[model samples]
Target: MSPRRHRGMLLLVLCWVLLAACTAQPTTEIAGSRPVDTSARAMLGDLRTLDPCTLADTAALQRFGAVSNAGIVSLDYCLLHLKPDDRTLIQLAVGELTGPDSDRPGDPVVPQGALNIVQNAPVPGHCTRRVRFGDGVSLQVSADLLAGEPGAGLCGIADAGAEAVAGAVQQGRAGHRDFPPNSLALVDPCAVLDTAAVNQVPGLEEARPRPSVGGHQCSWGEQSADAPRVQLQHTAGEPPRILHGAAVEEPVDGRRTVLSVVGGDPQVPLCSAETGHIPFGTVAGQVEVAQLVVAVPGETGTDACAYARGLARLAWPNLPPANP
Candidate 1:
């Protein structure tokens, strides 16, 4: 999401300055073509209800003072919290390990009943553990224990969390198996926006995968890890659920700005400019409704919002028209 071409130009500022102020659409249920097979194929659907906040059972990681520090969940990614914040603590990311990348083997280890487990240190001081359950379920944990509450045994704790996630998914999304239905669950995020349009962003001609777990994160920026010129996802609750009745903020350009304070969470930076608002009827109004999200890391200045808004506007003409 971003401002129109005429938002008086973008002002470049530091990343932290984006804490200024904002608001944050809706409805759709695209049914899948695959039949429900509970034996081994149902795990992904069951994951929709997995709350990242409670994914790691307290009893499992007893030795540590691990407590929820505000976790965010979506259709594909979850970022669990670790207490005693000091920039160093527990970090967990659980997401689908599909595509050709999952087949590539790495350092070996074995978790109970897991199809494959690979533990690797991508960078110094950081350890990442990945587990693949035979049912196409892959979970990962990355730990860089700096100066935090439970500094030691970060890897072990992450593994425990991974194990817990597997068990939880097997137990079936906490009995919320039949959720309200996420319209964008099976959508291919790349298809949401046109490549030609995405190239319009100054430094985004090259796109990279978001280095985090949760949601399908792809950024159009330099290969510099989290630095994204434009980022996109179709995950659950990342942009927060849009509620009716409240008037959504629409600026003079007809573009919706995704402010930093969205849902009162300064961490989420996004903006959206949509065409022809259509009330969600049975929710599945269009492909972009709840299924597609465009964002900026809020690194520069207000262009993060403008970029998001502009991208949304550029991609709109290509999107399916609103359901009448």
Candidate 2:
């Protein structure tokens, strides 16, 4: 054989041999391994100036009016929200890590193995803080501890890591605006998994984060078309810290019109609305969904509700009620 062809064959054989060894070995070494630090508090300060939407301290959550919002503070929670349907696989992986029989020999399922790494490997503490916004958005941030590793836990890590990287990039592009909507600005979870070399799990297709837009698209979408409206409202006794928004689906002539009205003082945009859309073929083969995002900015106090209501009214005319 020609020298170049011989080298190619040798390389291919080496890959096959490595694959065989991985397949033959059992995944028992990772279970109940020494616990790694995965705390969110440790990383909070570093990320504070990174994104205005994130609070450096839990106590500061109140200042941002997150008391009644759905709080998210763990890498696990963040992964769940970012990819809700993959909860079972992720939880199973965590269970394996925490379980007594983790080292016991079994089939080398990819998802379970990936979860084991996340549960056992250490991560910065500050990435675990839960932030809630009462309305529709809640965030729990964490670093992807196992980006280049192979195995079950690798899948989740790749997905979450890509998301974190994507989020950071998108936020940077948006200049850290307040109340950003959930745009598919993160890397494709599936592509991340595929590149990470953890594609052996059954039903792996279901665990992937499909893109809403087409090839080579940026991770995040553009800013909302309408300017955010701000409002502050008072309750009976509590030191008010509540933010609210509505994401309602309105169907129009065989099409869906999604109207999102967000209300808060100093409203922090979580994800961009103009850029957020469900991926094609994610839900029963649907390709795209229309969305409208409106921000209501300012700090919390009296008149917040009134301002929100007015904005909703304005949006109502744009959407109109769906026919029965």
Candidate 3:
């Protein structure tokens, strides 16, 4: 063969070799590789007596790791730990669990959605509720009756017996209005409380400290009251539009300042962003409560108070000391 033709034949042979290697690769979707084990599923049946939170903890993961790998599934308790809000809980439980090779398509093993509805039902006092997640696990949730912990009582449990005591420590602490009754819906409980923290004291615009980023000035002010507290305002645009009645309070424990952003007329949207990024003129605030820090995004409004309040709650301390 001519020199040019020989080179061309060699290239063709290499291309064919690469194609064979690609086609020989194993297919990721193996039918019985991760088969659902009925025996493992039976083990989870008795889990109804255990606490959902406890089952979701690291210890539970360790205990059930083998079974989970064997195809005995459970809910993604980590996501539930992130935001214990009932709505978020319901969404996560009902939504898909994404990660690893465990893409088994089905509802969560714990039926949290049904339990959420029962918890919100207009019954007086606390109630115990039970939900089956799927083939593997079940959840026994003890919902509080009133707003706060002390006032909250276990009303009843639907599927599980009331006497069943499951020791599921909440993976993460609950924030303000994290799990409010159904009638109340989910209001930013921190709205009123945080507003008070941010606008507690006058001259916050001046006395507050500033955090410098690049060359721009990032100023911070605080207002706080009771459980809710608002961090200093960090605006990147024109002077933030002030809202009426928002107040700031003296710092508690000398570590954090509190702000109270009240609700009502001229409601504002805090933490507004046109795209994913907060706009140049947008304002942001943090509310630190317990273990969660809520980020409030600024929005367009005659008054920036509502957004301020939301931001304050979102940025609440992870484990703020109780008000004295």
- Per-residue lDDT of candidate 3, residues 1-324 (tens digit): 112212222221121110011112121222556433222123232211211332333332222111111111111111121112332211111111111112134422332221111222324543333332222222333332223233222332222321121222111211111221221112122321333344443333233332211111122332222112122211111212223344333333333332333231233322211001122211243121211111232322323434443444444332222341
Candidate RMSDs in order: 12.0, 23.1, 25.3
Alpha-carbon shift of residue 304 in model 1 (angstroms): 5.6
CA lDDT, candidate 3, residue 9: 20
Tens-digit per-residue lDDT, 1-324, candidate 2: 112212222221111110011112122234668532222212222221123223222232222122222221111111121222232122101100011211224423223221221222324311221121111112223322212222324334433433343244323321221211222222222231121111121222133222211111111111222323221110011111112343333333333333332332224331112111232212242222122222323422222333323333333233212231
- Candidate 2 stretches with Cα past 4 Å from truth are 1-247, 251-254, 262-279, 282-286, 299-324
Better of 1 and 3 by lDDT: 1
Model 3 RMSD in angstroms: 25.3
The 10-residue segment with the lowest total lDDT in model 3: 13-22
Which regions of candidate 3 fall more than 4 Å away from where they truly are?
A: 1-154, 158-228, 231-324
- Kindly provide the TM-score of model 2 when superposed on the true structure, using C-alpha atoms: 0.20
lDDT winner: 1
